[model samples]
Target: MFPKAHQYVNIHAHRLAISQDEWVLTNLFAGDDFPGANETAYYSTGLHPWHIKDADSEQLIKKVELAAENLKVLAIGETGLDKLIQTPLDLQLQVFGAQVEIAERRGLAVIIHAVRSYNELIEFAKVHQPAAAMIIHGFNGSFQIAEDLMKAGYYLSFGHRLLISDKLKDVVTHIPAEKIFLETDESEHGIRELYKVVSELRNISLESLKVMIGENVKQVLRIR
Candidate 1:
């Protein structure tokens, strides 16, 4: 947990920017360089599907394992299936499963990047039944798909897209508060703005929404 109180928490972000002590969980891909340590932020690192084609499979897995052991690294991914990418589904599945195993071993939650592959991920979740929390970041899927994942005990994270997509707005209103999260996810939007949008959609005050999401983050990441 951060030292500051009542700060808007960005559950996932890419580029790290200076903030007024707001909590942020920055994402780092497995085959790339780690972020600088000047900022106070939590991190999640894994092999993204877009880089899987050129990444060294063995070394990538080792890197994820090593990163997961870090106290500052609270989650295991930004990793999952992406059918739109050129990486073979088989290889994606293999790498995703390996990261899930590592997350399970280290007791860290996973931040998944799923695109056009919800069914595949759901099936994988059923088979693996991971003990660690699994959050699907940047989720903009159908309500049925969201329901399916929620039923399977996965959390759904909404990003800046929620502000523009009516479908996503509808989906967000119905998700249980306990199973929902909000993120910036490489978007330029402020986390506070995203929270306001979600608060209005859910018919709750921003403070209440932030408290709920903060608790969810604490529970999922096992933060004290």
Candidate 2:
């Protein structure tokens, strides 16, 4: 079974520093991708905290607007707060807010790149109450934090690192199975490995979890 493709809402460029060849080959999102041309792009964009530094602010905003407008840029970004970096947190928040506004304006979802700034991010979410769902991508927070985010009605996407987390397991156990999702996030591991961990954690058969996650992924990303 080749990738046994499921409907993916979006695939961001954060994990894709090069041409999007893998998803291009997988046809996991949309129509056929030309062998060498820009891959049949996923419905999302992955913008990490670091990538925005060199990006021209006005141009970046315009690009975000264009993506939200013309292309099927269904998700604003993997943008959020990070504490350890030299990039100004205020500037980051400005960029993050601008993207969020763009998504809000266009009624698109957001793939958040939150780190130690959960409270700040949550506060922003609370105030704006954006219609587009917010998914905490690459989550690695404590169980309490996860619970808090879940209670606040946000979604979470799990990658390889989260799979190895005992704390995340504890947190994940409490998460509504509907909100749980497994992803590779550009890691070498296949979705099957992620599905394996999820199946065990949810105490369901692999096939069952596969069906559930497939449905969940589609629902979150608004995929058909």
Best of the candidates, lDDT: 1
Query: How well is each residue in 1-224 modelled by candidate 2, as lDDT tens digits?
Result: 11233432223323432322133112111111212323334445434566665446656566556655533355666667787788888888888888778777776667777878888877777777767778787788887777778767678877778567888777666678788755566677665566667678778887676566656655555431
Collision pairs in model 2 = 10-44, 12-46, 13-46
How good is model 2 by TM-score?
A: 0.78
TM-score of 1: 0.93
| lDDT tens per residue, model 1, 113-203 | 9989999989988998989899999998989999999988899999999989999999999988899988898888888888888889889
lDDT of 1 at 203: 91
For every model shown, what is its TM-score relative to the native structure? 0.93, 0.78
Report the poorest 10 consecutive residues by lDDT, candidate 2: 24-33
